[model samples]
Target: MKIVVQNLKTGKVFLADAPKPAVPDNGILVRTSASLISAGTDRAVVGLARKSTVGKALARPDLVRRVLRKVKNDGLWSAYKAVQNVIAEPKTLGYSLVGEVLAIGHRVEGVAVGDRVACAGAGHANHAEVAAIPSNLFVSVPQGVADEDAAYVTLGAIAMHGLRQANQQLGATVLVVGLGLVGQIMLQLCRAAGLKVIGLDLEEAKLDLARKNGVLIAAKPDDPGLAAKVAAATDGYGVDAVLLCAGSKDSGAPFEDVAGHCRDRARVVVVGDVKMDIPRNAYFKKELEILQSRSYGPGRYDPDYEERGRDYPIGYVRWTERRNMKAFMDLLASGALDMQVLTTHRFPVERAAEAYDLVIGKTPTFTVGIVLTYGPGEAEEYKPAPKARRKVPGKVGLGIIGAGNFAKGVLVPAMTGTGGFDVRGVVSARGLSAQAMKERIGAQYSDSDPGRVFDDADVDAVVIATRHDSHARYVV
Candidate 1:
């Protein structure tokens, strides 16, 4: 399999060959068909990563602090190299993808091989030939949805969660600040909920979709008379809620506009990366409430719920992440959301970098959404590469099977720091992560083949750090 990996330091993005990932008992192996590129989230990462070294350090003070700590512990040269390594860290991109289930875990139910499913997760639902998606992170695609449109599952869940945060009643009036992809989804969602929607953005072009999609009013956020428009649309009561869906470096981007146009006691739900510097005077008099919407919904960051498939009972939590995603799909199934209108560009997975160029404005084009298409993934085994082993006396040859965050950040570092083992090879579900870790630790080789390690007489021991359900299979 081939997967996309981006270099954080230089912003060099490329596709690299990797081994086919083993499916966890609580997950499924999916061969990706389509994936969505996020203008806000993915763009932020690429933009920040492409910044100068000083800019990168400034943007991430936590990394700066780490460098300082490293200086105190290791020598300056080693600290500098550590900083380089940190800057050069590779990240898997794309969180929303639709694919065909090539295989399913024994624990998986109500799903089978050959099912088309939409997957969501930072690393699990990536822009790759194949992804190992935990059951909770994916839902079967409906008959009505296409692979490209079904790829909107993650963003739709995000937009739906933002709407949920507002808690508006039918026919209630609301304002959506920023008519980007998520904002467009919000527009349709608000319409589906029978809510009166007002759309605001800096660019008039962005508001066109909102206007066409039944938004009562579409105008620039800075329009001096925007409050009057909102007032007229709401019958003089102003909007009942404001959903902030724009990302900006400006701390005070549209808060004043948001505050001035909102009805008294109206709530503000922030769904984007834009900073909030609520004008106390502008909003305090109204006694407005401020709410923050987390990504997707409940069960989002819960490892047990997502990775272990421990679903929250519907009786206790009405809308878990999976349920929210399902609602989005249901809307698509009911013909509420025209995913076609939302998608503007299509590129083969091979042109991923070019697609990103369009996203980052390097190509100077407007877009609501970009989809990366993939060919039917033909399963390929890991072909052994020529080996060069660092033979050291009295040292164990350690082969690792997982390159997840915990494994790379903790386990590998702990073992290597002991000066008693040579990291002979790495095998991970996502080959890109394994390759990165192998180069970082000076491993002899990296691939998706466990047999490379299991069959090698030089390998002294193996560490199984994959999902818990797969541990027994690894042991056997």
Candidate 2:
């Protein structure tokens, strides 16, 4: 299968042919129809990945800390080689997509082959012709929701989860700090919930669009009298909730201005990359509470819930990620929200680089919703994955069965320095951990099943890096 992959070292985006991803017993394989490129998220990700080693270290101190620890444990040469291996790998992009299920796992329920569904997950639902979507990350697409529209489901659920963070009444007002795609969707959600919304953004076009779309008021953060204007919008009640959606570099999101005029006890829900430098005095006096909205909802980033399909009881956690997706789809079907309005460009999978140019500000044109369409793709222009990491064939192919910290930070780095072993695959109890390890270590593939590694022809040696409790089972 051909998929879009970015070189971590060069930040060069292109199409590469690789073996079709295996559908887990808990997942399904889908032929991708359409996928949405998230401008804010994707740009930030690719930008960081493309930077020089020093630049990457400077940008991420936590990673640097991990490297320092590895150096301390394994010596300098080992740590350096490990870092090289990480950046040499390709990265998969795109997390929101709509596709037709081509195959289903025996354990998957309430879905079957030929059904149209929206899939979410960084590695699982990629900018590829095909995606292996886990049960928890995909939802059935209702009738009337176009593939492109449904591709916006992940972002919509993110916006919905942000608004859900704020405990509000129907008549309460929310102040949205960023008016990009997520902020745009948040507007529709707030309106659908019968709440008044005030919007803030640097782009006049976006502010104008917000006004036309029924935002109670919209203004640039630097606009004179912005606080007073927000005060006027709510008839002096002030903002009841503040949803911060600005990017990481945007240190000047008008939150301070709005903070001074907000109602007592108003909640602040942070959903984006903005800095968290709150003034103690103002918040202390207002007795306001600050909260963070995890991406999507309760099931996100939880291996047990997302990979193993163990759902949080709806009675306890009513609006899980899947539920949020369903609600967003319902709103789309009811015509209360439209993703087409935000779409500024549509490109075939072949032209994804052009779409990303606009996303990262390399092209200065006003743009949003760069949708990539697929129609019987992989004809030409696909190159065999450069330096196939999946199998070394006659070489010393090593398979790793754990992705815990010790494996990634210590043992893996030590092995890379040996220079003879081709790290073929990695397994983790948690799907994301395995995927993350694969990206960092340039593995052929990642899966929760260690049997794929043990049973493969190319794997000449296996490392039992998992917990000791599971060692006897694998060894036997």
Candidates in order have lDDT scores of 0.86, 0.84
Q: Each candidate: RMSD to true structure? A: 3.3, 4.7
Please list the residue runs of candidate 2 whose C-alpha ends up more than 4 Å from where it truly belongs after superposition: 249-253, 377-476
Query: What TM-score does candidate 1 reach?
Result: 0.90
TM-score of each: 0.90, 0.84
lDDT of 2 at 94: 91
lDDT of 2 at 256: 70
Q: Write the per-residue lDDT of candidate 1 for residues 1-476, one digit (tens) a residue.
A: 77777888688777776666777778999999999998888888888878998898777789789778978987787677555555455778899999999889899999989989999999889899899999899998999788888999999999999999999999899899899999999989999999988898887778887787878899986678877777788888888999999986558657776887888899999999877777888777999999989989999889999888999988999999999999999889899888898888999999998998987889998888999999975535344467666657699988999887668766788899999998888997657778788888889888777878898777889999887967987774
Top candidate on TM-score is: 1
Question: Clashes per prediction?
Answer: 0, 1
Model 1 scores worst on lDDT over the 10 consecutive residues at 376-385
In candidate 2, the residue pairs with backbone N, CA or C atoms under 3 Å apart (3 or more residues apart, or in different chains) clash, namely 390-444
